[model samples]
Target: MFSLMYETPSSWVQDVEALGTLTLLSDHAHCELKAAATMQALVAKNPTCDSIVRTLPRFAMEELEHFEMVEALLRERGGKLAEQDTSPYADGLHKGSRANRKSLLLDRLILSHIIEARSAERFYLLSEHLQDRELAEFFGSLMPSESAHRIMFLRLAEGLFPAEDVQARTAELRQMEADLISNLPFEARIHSGPKQ
Candidate 1:
């Protein structure tokens, strides 16, 4: 987890429509990497938990593949991974245990789902803005997988917590995610280009 001290300007999104596909790829790769590590921890902590453990192997594998694919894309584009500071994007969503163990897991599960769901939504949005034919095609190809990731996380959350609790957690985490995305000072990325 990184600190939330860094912020990017939202206006940088102007160039995203052009570079948006690459941006989507970058975001997806980062998301999967973070997710895989987090899922590994969750599965290890709850080793005997069949549902959680069973899902992690697949998730981890997919994430690794996604990371490689993104790197390949970057290489093809004649670009390397820039040291983009990522603090604002990660904060707030993850609320650890506050004494009660159950609440902690619930919070973790909710945060994970929010991350995946938001990734799916953002990927879909970026896919719409992509211009390059190959990139556009790639983004389109990823939509179903991204949707599946969200569903898997949501189902995992539901399985681990009560229905009401799952609902409440989803609402809470979604708000947190929204706050992070909406309030961040827009920084220019491959997707978030310069403000027009």
Candidate 2:
């Protein structure tokens, strides 16, 4: 029942091709590791937050599996993983986040929802249009995982605090997330800005 902060534009499918399929696969591989790292980090930061501590490791493992899948595809396509440029898309969202410990956790939890929700939408778009059936199938397969993760984060948020409070904060964060997406310069990455 979760929603994306941003709806990927119709142009993004065509735009993905501009980056070349290899680049897309490589970026996807890198993103999976980043997702895992975030989960591990949350686990570390909130040792006393047993809810996060118990859940994040399992999610991290799932992300690693996704990374492996994308890495395999990248290698198969003659693409080698290399240094990726800093993502303005991520940096911009992070810059607006609150700094206090409690707020950080809440914001991060909500941010996870935003990230997965957006990823789910983009993967669906890519899955629909990717010419190769195998690649399309692979991306298509990720939607369920993305959907689960997105929902899990929101559930955790509600579990941690009052439902109404979480909803209020989520509304604030969601608007910020959408604005962040709409304003950034477009790129071919899955979480990049809206198409120009």
Candidate 3:
């Protein structure tokens, strides 16, 4: 299975729904755009292979479209994309990634995978737990792509590195992510810290 690298806490669900930071939806819109940009940057900086150069533009476009859809969702709900701070959860993960230029590409790819997987998992939670029917439906629709992107990132990393190397790094990162989620204080932003 497709178990998440980390399980979101039950209380996080309860807190999000209760605190009414529906702007989390807005945060998601921003995240999709950021994801798209990340891919675009990777494609631009390292055009060594035609496969990514050709494919990443399409993927980036898809992510931008997702951002649009989420924006629409926010507008329909009488909300605007809230100005929020950067997600500590994601910052922590990125901070933990290898900073040396030699391995940076592989590290970035794996980090992107971890972030996408976490988003996919959170979207599933929103779909299952949110009170609004329309919003829940929308959230459910978004999960497949996030999951797909997670797998895509993994494949890209494997293509760049030995399978065993990728696997080991992925496991290390997954454990790091899980521990981070478990230990951090919760917040209302999308990809915020773990529920506490």
Each prediction's Cα lDDT score? Answer: 0.61, 0.82, 0.80
What tens digits encode model 2's per-residue C-alpha lDDT throughout 3-63? 7556767578777776687877877888889999999999999899888988889999999
Q: Which residue pairs show backbone clashes in model 1?
A: 8-185, 8-186, 8-187, 9-185, 9-186, 9-187, 10-186, 12-192, 12-193, 13-192
Error of 2 at 72 (Å): 0.7
- Highest TM-score among the candidates is held by which one? 2
lDDT of 3 by residue, 1-196 (tens): 2345678865676788776746678888889889999999999998887667876898899999999999987888898987867677778888766533237777888888888888888888888887876877888999999899899888888877898888878888888888777777766666876655
Report the Cα lDDT for candidate 1: 0.61
Tens-digit lDDT track of model 1 for 1-196? 1111223232232355444445545555665677678888888888988998888788878877877887788778876655545645665344322323457767777666656665555455445654466765665676677678767877887887789988865665665556556654444332222233
Ranking by lDDT: 2, 3, 1
In TM-score terms, candidate 2 sits at 0.93
Question: What local lDDT score does residue 51 receive in model 1, on the 0 to 100 scale?
Answer: 93
- Candidate 1 — which residues are off by over 4 angstroms? 1-14, 17-28, 95-102, 188-196
**How are the candidates ranked when ordered by TM-score, highest leading?**
2, 3, 1
Off by over 4 Å in 2: 99-102
TM-score of 1: 0.78
